[model samples]
Target: MRLEQKYTALLGDVQRRAIGGGVPSAIGQLRLCFEALGLASAIDADCATRLGRHGLSEGKFVLLSLLRDVPEGLSPHALAERAGVTRGTITGLLDGLERDGFLARHADQVDRRKLLVRLSPKGEAAASTLVDEHAQWIASLFADFTPAEMQLLSALLEKAWRKTDRGAA
Candidate 1:
């Protein structure tokens, strides 16, 4: 309700400015952007709550998920690339996950100077559970949407994404 009020107030301000021909076009775009932001925030909060139960942040969960099947493990560099994070960020994630006993790191067999990261048994189990639950949660959220509707929505989102993917404020 409060968010809706704010959205209406914003539209009112735009109209009051007498922006003329642009107002009609801007209204739809502005409304869509606001709704998208609200949805993103809601989804993020949901993910945080779910991850908190397992003592995992999104970053830690991503690492575990990546290593779930990688018995041989990956180097810190590889994980960083996979997760699209900096080396320092990857190191921190690995340190926290390792401390929690969710993953392990060891020197590479062929390259002793390099370390490889792998999931511990506990991490493997948690990853499986989390992935399954997350999938179910996402599906449930969209249960009311028909398949056709879902496709349309997805397509629209992709189109909208193209506009904001570069040089967007």
Candidate 2:
């Protein structure tokens, strides 16, 4: 069966199981969903807080992180792809970063039609500081997890992500 059909059947089974268990109401399921969303939002907020000190929002930080790995910088299209954001959004982000002296956009030397983005001196300094802080913050977040538990969690997350990507493809 197609993945969608399999997913739909799985969902139906879950609903049936829930109903058979004398679940109080749909509200319980809604609450669970909300709680999951809350956790995700909180994680994102924490990252944003850490990034904000270096004049970067979560999205901007993601973009800069992508750029940091490529000294020559990436074209806007490639940056958007790596950042998992829209072209327009990347454009606006680049504009904001440039205005704040974090990055600069210039025509590619070999291809004038393509714009290349690079971090300015100020931006590189900010990025280095933010990267260090982010590493510490991430380490703290998982401080409670044992090495085995962390490995297991990472594997599970990667598996789930691969499954999701396959379905999307």
| Model 1 spans with C-alpha error above 4 angstroms | 1-9, 18-25, 165-169
Query: With candidate 2 superimposed using the best TM-score fit, by how many Å does residue 140's alpha carbon deviate from the native?
Result: 1.6
Per-prediction backbone clash count: 0, 0
- Which parts of model 2 are misplaced by more than 4 Å? 1-35, 152-169
lDDT of 1 at 17: 63
Top candidate, metric lDDT: 1
Q: What's the lDDT for all of these models? A: 0.86, 0.77
Q: What is the per-residue lDDT of model 2 for residues 1-169, given as tens digits with 9 covering 90 to 100?
A: 1233444465566677778886544644544444545666678888877677667898888777777757788888999988888999999999999999988988999989989999888888777777667878878988999999999978875665576657457
Compose the digit string of candidate 1's lDDT tens values, residues 17-60.
Answer: 65665545466677777777777878899999999999999999
Instruction: Supply the global lDDT for candidate 2.
Output: 0.77
| Residue pairs in clash, model 2 | none
